[model samples]
Target: MRQSQNGGKRVLIVGGAGYLGSILSRKLLSNGFKVKVLDVLMYGREPIEEMLAHDAFELVEGDMRNISTLVKAIERVDQVVNLAAIVGDPACTLKPADTIETNFLANRALAEACKYNQINRFVYASTCSVYGMMEGDEKLTEESSLNPVSLYARSKVQAEEGILSLEDENFSPTILRMSTLYGYSPRMRFDLVVNTMTKNAVIDKKIFVHGGGKQWRPLLNVEDAAEAYMRVLQEPLKNVKGQTFNVGSEEQNYQILDIAKAVKESVPNAKLIVEGEEKDLRNYFVSFSKIEKTLEFKAVKQLKDSIFRIKKAIEDNRFSNINDPKYYNVEIG
Candidate 1:
């Protein structure tokens, strides 16, 4: 592919300091893409601090709620990936207004700005939580009805609609309904299920299972999630435009207990403490056939590899304090 500007590919990732974005920016920059990250630095700059020295990487510290910020960020860019938002259910519940503005409103505005700027490829990071909890045993596809059980999922549902509403011949907006992300990222987070369990297995010697450990959750490694985005960025417009693909593998779906057990197996000595009550309502086995069939994209990273990455990061003392607020999305102001 020909580079967009300065003989290199120029792409803007709105939330490029988050868990997945941190890994993604590195991948793009390594491939000679002139990467620009626009974030409020809610987490901190350390996730991407190493990238600051790269000649092809640029950081625009700003919020996605600002229209002018997005307009300036996307100007003359080949692709725009929107990973910015109040990500996760608890985080959204804690800040409903902020979630609405960022997840739904600003997301819609960003898509419009991309279209207006004549940027054809727009990737909106959605979640499979949109299919909140299905009653059936069969796996849900992109065509399945979205039963968003939380404010986080609901906001993404609306954002998906609003962005797709702007889709036309000129603007190719692709929505990736991503599965639950786990594994190590430069912008590390212990809030995710696999990451948390693995960390606890190594450090605390016990992993807490909030639910009965039977709730189904589809898993996708952060690296694999990044790869899915990269594939969409490279695919032909007709193949991906105005389409929604579940970014995960059906084989990766595992019950909560299964995930915890995987951690126990890896750590060997950690015990799984299963609680009687299950609170978080999301449970669904996702079908990633659409993305695999269309773009030839399937999650390549193994589930165990993800667990090992988090475990190794912890053993290496990557985070000064695991309980630090910077590691969570909701803890920030």
Candidate 2:
């Protein structure tokens, strides 16, 4: 039987200092679980320093590549949310070897550690990018044949298969293939499409639409993405255990130009520029009904709202160091 919410159950967040991991750590703490953050602290702890004051929160500064560190982190934790990785296509492209070692091999090490430690509930944060270069408007589901175009997506697909294949009577690993996330974060990243356009509008007073902006992509606010992890933590084991759920909202799909226009509506003075002879290969609308039906989870933030938040952040000088390498992936660094 699955363990219920008790006072002593520990939750270990593998990359708790990164964008999504930072948010999930706080949410888990609020829900009465002891939170242990195991991250390299690549960007620093300013994002989650406040959480350290909580009696139930612990931080382990280490890399996921170190199997000894991973084994130590999982020691007594009831659940493990694996968010450690060299994220994004450009980042993976820059360091292909490191990406594979960290994203795939490290995850395999973590799964083995989890199995050895008897920590069953393993939640993997994957990407919708696994359904690379889709044709037409068909919404890609969990069963959809994966067609990964980028090295990063391929790494995630390999890791997902490796982790899920480890499922047994004792260990129940759950995979969440998250859509393109946008919105504010303590460790904010402006490289994402929505956030980048919003920042461009607020700072440069113009929005650039690449390749005429016709590429379709689904987006989810970062907060909603964090909430999906919480829902998985609370749901019945049978419903979520050993399952892969695509995290997103059906209504959130929009073309790149549409998102830019939404930003223009929010920032009226923002100009629109379309350029670039090259077109991006990734374009697809994802189906999120699987998670919605099983866990009753739905994204709460809209694209309009995300634009407003980002615009306001820029207006208030919250991101004065906009070009810092902290928010950029390996490629941009």
Best by TM-score: 2
For each of the candidates, give the backbone clash count.
Answer: 0, 0
Off-target runs (Cα >4 Å) in candidate 1 are 1-7
Residue 297 of model 1 has an lDDT of 83
Estimate every model's Cα lDDT from 0 to 1.
Answer: 0.88, 0.88
Which lDDT value does model 2 have at 172?
91
> CA shift at 12, candidate 2, in angstroms?
0.4
Model 1 over residues 1-333: C-alpha lDDT tens digits?
Answer: 312333476889989998999999998887677899999998799999999999989899999787777777887688899999888988889899999999999998888888887899899999999999888899999999999999999999999999999988889999999889998888888878888788788998998898698889999999999988878887777888899999998899999999988898789988888887888788999898888888888788998877887788788988888888888776633
Q: Candidate 2: deviation at residue 224, Å?
A: 0.5
The true-versus-predicted C-alpha distance at residue 333 of model 1, in Å, is 16
Runs off by more than 4 Å, candidate 2: 1-8, 331-333
